[model samples]
Target: MTVTTQPDYRCTPSPLHAILLAGTVPLFLGALLSDIAYYNSFQIQWTNFAAWLIAGGLLFAGLALLFALANLIRADRKAGRPVMYLVLLLVTWVLGLVNAFEHAKDAWAVMPSGLVLSVIVSVLAVITAWLGLSNLRSGGAR
Candidate 1:
């Protein structure tokens, strides 16, 4: 008797791609922290820090979104996990952009709304990172 096994071709991100996906969490979380600090201390510098961090987060998230798009295209079947991940990435990027615009307002005006958006964007970014980096493999058999 001959023993044969099927190969499992897992669809996963490359190391650099994974790094880009992972990078969004901290930058957004840092922005959230800055927003909180500004809310508490009423310091203008904190808003500046938050704005810069939001910009950085958007940069990384945009790169990761590109990678996710490539991954989705490279996928054998465009049905489940890849689609979901791509959607998540898109939502995160869009909301992050909105948060950036919100932060563009005056220091005092940025408050409350900016802080709320930061929290929501930060949560979305973390979820996107988690989903993108997790072991949710596509095009593989168990």
Candidate 2:
């Protein structure tokens, strides 16, 4: 007698896909920093093009994040507000950093508490964003 084994496949969508995709804060930051690096590396003017690239990336990323959250929240999704709130907090922290960078040497270190707070805020934002997106994507579909 011969025995054969069957393979099992999952029909449900992956929640982690949405989680990982939505959690692209680092990618966005990379784009922002790359814009700066482009200027420095090429001896280009900051006001000419690099700033625009960074600004555009930031705008698109922020809008995409907002829209994704809106879709999930409108679908009666759970555990989304905390993430959105933290994203906003991150924005505020970034704005502060920009202003501080205008004059402070070692701007990120100007306030030790702020540096710590920024990291905490960013980590919370990413984790919450992932959790929220994960909850949105794992449908009950077959």
Each model's lDDT comes to: 0.86, 0.41
Model 1 over residues 1-142: C-alpha lDDT tens digits?
Answer: 9997655556668898899888899999999999999999999999999999999998998998898888778777776777888998899899899999999998799989999999998898888777778766665543
TM-scores, each model vs. reference? 0.90, 0.36
lDDT of 2 by residue, 1-142 (tens): 9997543322221355344435445643443344345434643332233233334434544555555555545443343443454465356346534523421333223333433333443454455445444333322321
Cα TM-score of candidate 1: 0.90
Kindly provide the TM-score of model 2 when superposed on the true structure, using C-alpha atoms. Answer: 0.36
Native-to-model Cα distance after best TM-score fit, residue 126 in candidate 2, in Å: 9.1
| Clashes (candidate 1) | 0
Among these predicted structures, which one has the highest TM-score?
1
Tell me model 1's lDDT, rounded to 2 decimals: 0.86
lDDT of 1 at 40: 97
